[model samples]
Target: MDTSTGATVAHRSWRSRRLDPERSLGLRLTLTVVAAFLVLVPFTLLALLVLGAWPPLLRLDASIAGSFHGYARDHPAWVGLMTVWTHVCGPGPLRVAAVVVVVWLVRRGAPRLAVWVVVTMVAGGLLGALLKLLVGRDRPDLLDPVARAAGYSFPSGHALNATLAAGVLLLVFLPFVRYSGRARVALWTAALLVTVVTGLSRIALGVHWTSDVVGGWVLGVAVVASTSAAFTTWRSGSGRPSAHPLREGVEPELADQRPEGGRA
Candidate 1:
């Protein structure tokens, strides 16, 4: 009986320690590092394969690109729709949207959050550009092409920007959606939909290989995870409440403001 009582007490103690925000910060940061590594390693391997022109990857890229082009030729309407989706959700427009969000955040008195948004998007964009240049991969060469994009194609710019934009906006508005509810579900669904569809639009238009889209996704995710970890560290050091960005969003205080927060 005594042993049973002691075991119960120890379990409760351990659970409490795990729940302690101050104690868990290190673990959270470690997990972020591991996640970033997992994301980057795959991207690096893909870039290497592109550079070396690995046969298996090249065969796969050609097969997929050819199939997509075949379908694109038959379906003019679908091709047109994909073209519009690609352009509307492309990097340029998404960056503009991110800029608008930044302005909104600053006006709402969350300059830090605004800065985080800018840094995340800009850094992701610049990194994507750098990787594209370094990889120096060419776009899928399709005869009777349904769409066209001019750039190195190891990582689709549209995919990277859409992913970064989705991640930034999702984190920004997550708090406002109350963490859990239909609103939260809708926000996540929209972000995911935009990210995925933008990537697919690139493939469907016969402009990017499957590997290019995948690389973009991996790199974009790495950037977001890295920046989010840095922001969380800053919050902890500044004596803010513990942030579980995956759960409560990056800046919960954004949604917890009073009327005065909106005033000059």
Candidate 2:
């Protein structure tokens, strides 16, 4: 009888400690941000579509597409280079690489980072595909040295993949990598530049409208932000151990500290 009473008391005590509110603010905040982002992004995109904003957007797309079309028509060598580069940076291969990297991170015990990467990729890819289907915008039809692509082109996949990849990489490395501030800045700069160039490549290849690329970038950024917030919450709730050795053996004083590193 005494043993049973003692066990019940201990269980209640553990529950109280686990549910302590002060340590969970970060988690609450992160979840709130994620919820807000999920609501806002789709609404904004729908508003833009419903307001008939595509005409002006498409005109801008054509102007940018025209320059690439002209350049590709005149410079066969440059066109060939761009064609190859575009294929190299296309959604299929980049997404595969992203998956491999994410799996590697998970195996390395950075499961939170891995989850964020995979979530961002899947969310961005699905969202982009849905938007493309709904918009159903035609690609620029013009003289091009490179082979033409066919599909309902809105929200360029290249741009989506580039932005998501850059965003995921930055999130994964920034908090974890032991790098100088200048190096971190340089790394981010390079990532941003790569993302921009990837988006531009779609326009250059005459495979996507300018609006498509811009929309993709916007969606990608939103996905990154929202997914990061959700990941932060999940990591917090799971009671994972600290990666920092100095913090080893210290009982988690906050919600962000999870036992077993939040592994399922």
Candidate 3:
């Protein structure tokens, strides 16, 4: 072959390999970096606002807190419900639930999936706590408060942990419902409801500002996305078939493995 033609063929082959998402670690790393940038940028901006005590955000936080506190003070029933919801979905309870899930996964012979759950939750929880300490923002101080909590509250731990739990549960169960459109929709809807309401419960109880909840939500999402991307990259490197989390769950192979109970 002519030198020019040989060069042309090599160039095309190189371009094709780079563009192949399944085999290209470079492409995956680039995507992971972009996703982290997108998630962290807003979170950092929010943290800055909190640290600076920006007047506008403070005003917004006050306005929402006042409104929610006003209603909470009047309706003893509503406050009661929120208090229950917050504790049930709080960081402590969620962490316990995650431990149970990890045990379940291990018993089912999915140790890797179990580790992912533990790592995702532990990393998110620690990051949230670290940010809270660094930000050193206080809880909403309201007269006649209906509910009380003790912590540095820039990012609500309840919100952060709940978001992590919701995301983990949805991904773990997605494979079971992958073939049923309605089941998939229900799973997503449930996750959204839990994550949203848990955060809202914190605000409604006058324990956290809206911005704190937002920061937690954003950070939680970033953790999940970052870890999921890492898991995907690992799967690709390990010769596993590429599967979308939303469509096939983080561990699609789990669907084929019966729980230990079913084996005997």
On lDDT, the leading prediction is 3
lDDT of 1 at 151: 83
The TM-score obtained by model 3 is: 0.92
Question: Per-residue lDDT for 112-170 in model 2, tens only?
Answer: 56666787899889988887788776777776336677777777778888888877766
Please give the TM-score that candidate 1 achieves against the real structure: 0.88
| Predicted candidate 1 versus true structure: per-residue lDDT over 1-264, tens digit per residue | 699999999998776655555566655666667878888898898888888999999999899988888988999999989998988998888999999999888777788988999999989999999888888888888888888889899798888989999999998989988746989899999999999999999999988999999888888888998898889878876878877786668988888764335543
Model 3 lDDT per residue over 100-191, tens place: 99999999989988999999999999999899889999999999898889989989898999899999999998999999999999999999
| Candidate 2 vs candidate 3, lDDT winner | 3
Clashing pairs in 3: none
Q: What is the lDDT of candidate 2?
A: 0.68
Q: What is the C-alpha local distance difference test score of each model? A: 0.86, 0.68, 0.90
Q: What are the models' TM-scores?
A: 0.88, 0.72, 0.92
